[model samples]
Target: MNKSVPANVTIVDHPLVQVKLTQMRRKETISSDFRRLLKEISLLLAYEVTRDLALTEREIETPIERAMFPVLRDREPCFISILRAGNGILDGMMDLLPSARVGHVGLYRDHETLEAVEYYYKVPSDIADREVIVVDPMLATGHTAVAAIERLKKDGAKNLKFLCLLAAPEGIAEFHKGHPDVPVFTASVDKKLNEHGYIVPGLGDAGDRIYGTK
Candidate 1:
């Protein structure tokens, strides 16, 4: 983990995660492979992000006997993906949390100011009452993340976590500055953002690669 990254930020550094990330970063990786890798990595990332979820004991009867089993105390957590690219991660996350409610926050960054402008936003009606995890493959400039978090907060979401496959130090800093209470999870925090505000060495525009737009 980079010392400069906020304490709240967690880097999932498992060997599998690293290998998958490396494969995804290669320019030659096809859209199908890229999408598959993203989903695989997102499931790995989901495990770490949901580690602290509250659990409760439940009385259940097994085939042989009755016993108390531990189960999630709350209803399934809500997942909010940040538009087009976020959908890639959402699929993997759902693999782990099949019952979780899903939401989408559509935002596009203004190339000139590097600010996020929201074009769409929607979430579960009970969003305010459940744990909410925001998923995006890359956290580059962080403006889009900050904007998305702000919107979630405004809509009464209190418990929030941001998850990404890769993050830039600049984005992490900006994110923490805007929403200090929200923790961030990522597979890797790369060197830094470039002049154009993209994470250096990041798996290029996640949406483009995942959907073969480029």
Candidate 2:
């Protein structure tokens, strides 16, 4: 399989991201704590993901003097969370971009076919003109990622990005191979996927960990 992931697809290696991930990995972390850490880590990841957002200057009058103000140049980025697991990451990103538009895509892996089956999808009507960031806590198989992107592309979204908490090498390769132009941001890339398609040494099912369900 192709191991060459995008050079632009950054995996954040900050100490804080690592520390929070460690807490998230612990088996004892309860749903509440897991949810909290997911939010915090998502915010940190957002910092890197949005670093290059265009900024514009505007003149402003301060209490004492006139000054130049800087704000995001393009329309604020829209967030598209990939359902249940993605919502954990979305909560944090929303705290940072509260005014930004939000979208949802619901997908489930069909047990029999092992395919990504979409049940619901909604996005801003003006997606073609806005930058979009797709969030999901885990990118395990890349099937969902590829399918999700395909849906987004069909919706007319141009500039698109994918962000995840963790990914496996196989999944990362699959994503890149399927959509080499899209950049991905992740916290860590694990060794590989196990027999049942779980990322080995991963923090278990992210949804189960965050929601306290099996």
Candidate 3:
């Protein structure tokens, strides 16, 4: 619908993310290692994503002396993992920001219509007051991801971010067209979507790979 996605959308090209992404893409990678690498890469990506988070000074006593130290503002960020595939990224982001609250949103794309249909949705206590990040592995077509963000906005989340391991240009455009105010952070943007809607030269079905299913 809309073609204007944020030019600022970062495709984290860090060498470590690239290396881990390569491992995740291999067909031989087992669920255990897949999950582990996803977690590690997610954490690394989170580090870059949170670089601009607001911080405040707080008085703390170190082993040596008492001084004011910069800490994440008293505010706690909230994370929403789009079910199944998103959970892999969730593990990593959680490991990085243990203090952040968590939520889950589940949606299934209809086999025939290819339309997103929500199955489950749950969020933190007061999402309006906190920064919210939605994690999903692939941003293809952007139908489900955009729908997810619409639900989050309806629920009161003012600040939002979308995190994905890989994204296609078409999907990214669709997403930003709908929510231009929100920013997306992703590991890499592959070439283009094939006729079947899979990203070309892209990692295969993320949900299947992460959970060890077909």
Candidate 4:
């Protein structure tokens, strides 16, 4: 992690994560490969982000005797996808947590203003009680994430975390400013954002790559 990144951020620096992230960064990687890599990386990220989930002991009957087993103490968490690109990461995380509730916070960044404009928002009615993990592929200008989290908080969501594949120092800083209490989880934090508000040396536009829009 870079010194400029917030202390609240957690970088999943596993060797497998680094390798797949490097492959995703390559321009030669096709849409199919890029999408596949994101899914694989999401699984790895999901594992790390959920590492601190609460657990409790449950006594169950075995063939010969009773045994105490560890099981999640709380209900399945909810995954709030930040629209199109987020769905890529959301899909993989869902594979590992099929029972987890799903939500969407639709937002788009204005080209000239570079501000996030929300069009829709929906989540489990009990969002205030359950853990919430917000997923988006890139943390570019950070406005989208900041705006999304703001909305979630307004809807009574108290426990929240942000997850992404690639991040920039600028984005992380901006994000921290907005939600200092919320932690960020990512595979890599890049150098900076370009003049166009894109993460430098990032995997290009994640939505474009994921849906072949470019």
Residue 80, model 3: Cα distance from true site in angstroms = 0.3
Candidate models: Cα lDDT each = 0.93, 0.89, 0.87, 0.92
lDDT per residue as tens, model 2, 125-205 = 988888899999888889999999999999898899999999888888889888888899999887888877888778998
Whole-structure CA lDDT of model 3? 0.87
Model 1 / residue 65 / CA error / Å = 0.8
lDDT tens digits, residues 1-214, model 4? 4556667999999999999999999988999999999999999999999999999999999899999999999988999999989999998899898999999999999999999999988889999989999999999889999999999999999999999998899888899999999999999998889999999888799999988998
Work out candidate 1's RMSD over C-alphas: 1.0
Of the candidates shown, which would achieve the greatest lDDT relative to the real structure? 1
Q: Given candidate 1, what's the lDDT at residue 101?
A: 99
- Give the Cα error of residue 1 in candidate 1, in Å: 7.3
Clashing pairs in 4: none
As for TM-score, the candidate ahead, 3 or 4, is 4
TM-score of each: 0.98, 0.96, 0.94, 0.97
- For model 1, residues 26-86, the per-residue Cα lDDT tens digits are 9999999999999999999999999999999999999999999999999889999999999
Candidate order by decreasing lDDT? 1, 4, 2, 3
What lDDT tens digits, residue by residue, belong to model 3 across residues 156-207?
Answer: 9988999999898988888988998889998888778887778777888899
Clashes of each: 0, 0, 0, 0
Candidate 4, run of 10 with poorest lDDT: 1-10
